[model samples]
Target: MLNHYRIMLVLCSSVLTLVGCTNEKAFERTQVEGVVTLDGAPVEQGVITFIPAGKGATAGANIESGKFVIPKEKGPSPGDYRVEIDSSVPTGNKILDTDGETMVDEYANAIPPKFNRLTELKVTLKNGNNQHLFDLEKE
Candidate 1:
């Protein structure tokens, strides 16, 4: 009976070892750069974020001069990503002034919520240099 128990234990251990072996590769990231334009014009100011589908880290870059560059060291692993952009026009409508006033506030975001707060953009990143361009419309 003792021998029988030992054999069962060994079999179970071997099965567990084999089950742990998988062929999936580790997360791999590559450099990426892109331009963001709105209504045929370059975005003035905003941020672009790449949220991975899963099993990878999120990446983001500031939009400066209508362009953004994500370095390889700071970019997400190669995979599908959900893109989000937040754009705004400089010197937006002034309102809500300081000194407890309800005027002179400047928070004018041209892009709609569907593109930023509720984005619907998707992209597939491969294992090499990538350049993506986003053309957005205001609603």
Candidate 2:
């Protein structure tokens, strides 16, 4: 019957549309690791972030003893990225807590603004494992 043929055609068209929509390829990831040092000494503790220069996901990792690792499963896609490093140190001053219940030691960013807020560091990631070392200076 004509109605039966029309129903079959509609079902086939719907199935083809769904299949076409699901065929997008996934983005590839690369493993990234690195060390951070300041004034020839290892940065004791810090955080590092990688922001894509164009279009991609941003990734970050915790720095412990100047070392950080971003596994492939959670790494960023290969591309250009701007690097930001942040670390904090006690300022030797006491400040009232936000709750005004107690005093807490004041802390300030140990790394220079050029390394974090207004970063100038950049890296180009490839399609495999990558290792980079960033040695920062005081001046």
Candidate 3:
């Protein structure tokens, strides 16, 4: 009976230590960078958000000169990531002519004008300095 108790205690301790090690490795922060290009041209003046694969912390960067560099944050768990843009423009009443100021179609909707669909780019971030370039196409 004493031998059985010792075996059980050892197994429980080993399992707990393994779980803690895995969690620490997962939540570690890392640097990530990338560029966004549309039709072979770098996208300028846009926000690129990185929504992680699961409940991981999100990160992003602002596009400049067709390039972007994400700040050091918690790295992803090595998987696919869906990319979306908050591409919305405000329609002001400061119109020049009636023809130019008309909301003919669904332009009045609150939905932002999507330059590209969500999930257009699937970025895979690893454990080191991650460099990626996304090229978009018209559907």
Candidate 4:
């Protein structure tokens, strides 16, 4: 009985030590949120992406809206990205008017327009919350 008790105590201590070591370090967390706009108007739909700052950084995507949010589990990092917006698609349609009057009817394409440089804003994230309001305009 004495020997069995000693073995159980040793096992319990080892388990406790392993569990404590597992939680030795905690990862820092950061968050980012902001609104995206163009020409003082809200951009309907767009895609927002994050590229990690340092070498071999990870990437994430958040769709475009009036607002966007990104969670940084790996703490704060630096990176460069190009934000883009999809403009309304262009559809080719022609209509004619009668009685000496000319009328033309047009429709937007089923596909949304794609802007390559809408989200091309450079930003940095440090220790806390980082917010950005992007107001893009056509050149």
lDDT of each: 0.85, 0.92, 0.61, 0.56
Could you tell which candidate, 1 or 3, scores higher by TM-score? 1
For candidate 1, write residues 21-93 as lDDT tens digits: 9867755778889999998899877899999887787889999978999999888888898898987564656
lDDT of 2 by residue, 4-121 (tens): 9999999999999988875356667789999999999999999999989997678889999999999998998899999999999999999999999999999999999999989999
* TM-score per model over all chains: 0.69, 0.81, 0.55, 0.54
Residue 93 displacement in candidate 1 (angstroms): 5.0
Name the regions of candidate 4 deviating beyond 4 angstroms: 1-6, 17-29, 74-120
- Per-residue error for 71 in candidate 3, Å, reads 2.4
| Predicted candidate 3 versus true structure: per-residue lDDT over 1-139, tens digit per residue | 9999999999999999888764454555556677777667676557677777665656666677667776565444444566654323345544345677655323222223353344555666666688887766544
Instruction: Give a tens-digit lDDT track for model 4, residues 35-123.
Output: 86767776666555555435324434444556777777643344333344344433567556555478566545222233343235556
How well does candidate 4 match the true structure in TM-score terms? Answer: 0.54
Question: What lDDT, from 0 to 1, does candidate 1 have?
Answer: 0.85
Least accurate stretch of 10 residues (summed lDDT) in model 4? 109-118
Error of 4 at 40 (Å): 1.5
Clashes of 2: 0
Question: Would you list the clashing residue pairs of candidate 3?
Answer: none
